[model samples]
Target: MPEAGIEPDVVTYNTLIDGCVLTDDSAGAVALFNEMRGRGIAPSAVSYTTLMKAFASSGQPKLAHKVFDEMEKDPRVAVDRAAWNMLVEAYCRLGLLEAAKKVVDEGEGRAAGRGDGKYKRMYVELHSRMFTSRHASQARQDRRRERKRAAEAFKFWLGLPNSYYATDWRLQHDGNLT
Candidate 1:
């Protein structure tokens, strides 16, 4: 299209990216997204959603999360329910049910205030799929194990002798262990 003297706008780039995503060409979609940014075309919510979907479909939920984080940090980009839906889907696909549930809960709260039925409906669908998934059990087990490890580590740290803390404080503050 550029060769045809038809300058690609944000919509054109989004369409190309969507095509790349649909064809399972996530790398190509990313390249086009970068090219779009390089050309000073600001990506809309749809652009980010498309890229997130591509990353999700490619089994790179972490990448999708990174894209979602970027969208959240960019004030120029308006994050709508569609972006949230994609993120929830990505987390669900990665077996991160807790993370997906967190997103769904947050989306539900936001939707409640906006009176948007679409957001609520999407949240319900994703929540049901997440809980019913086989990965849900694994996710729960992993979270429990993580919490147990964290508590044990914390207890060990807290159980250290007061003398050790005093020595460390003396070394830093007085330049000598008392």
Candidate 2:
């Protein structure tokens, strides 16, 4: 856009934000978003959704929620289920099962569009992430418990007073002990 002497607008920034998010560059996406706002470009749904997805995929669901909240307050930007699903998937990937389920439940209860086959696809993806996160978290917990038990055993041994004694012969001859 700069090369063509066409000033980059909100849409341009949004496109860049999507690219940055896809590449896992949430910071770059945020920077571009701020730059867009600084240039007095009113963000559209595209801008908001792109940023929301960026934050969600970056494991910052709170930030994504903030964007979604603002999107909801602004009548101009339509709140789409995809944005919600992005956040759901993010939370699921982080092992936040409740939050992920909340998103899904909200969508279902609120009559959020089925999006034809897209809703189910997103649901399956989110479910997969939840399972992966749960497995990974459980594995980590098991390893931690094992380490704690080993450490406790080591401590117990170290804390005991050191002593020595004869075995079989001393046991038989009680009078000749010491």
Best by TM-score: 1
| Clash count (model 1, backbone only) | 0
TM values, all candidates: 0.60, 0.57
Runs of candidate 1 with Cα error greater than 4 angstroms are: 109-178
What tens digits encode model 1's per-residue C-alpha lDDT throughout 69-152? 999888998888789879988988878877887877777677677887664474355434433334567777676555544444
Clash statistics: count for each candidate: 0, 0
Lowest summed lDDT across 10 adjacent residues in model 2 is found at 160-169
Q: Write the per-residue lDDT of candidate 2 for residues 1-178, one digit (tens) a residue.
A: 7888899987788889999998999999989988998998888887888888888788898888888888889876777757776767677767887787787677666664544554446445543443233456777767655554444443332232223212122433657422
Report lDDT per candidate: 0.78, 0.71
**Cα distance off (Å), candidate 1, residue 160:** 43
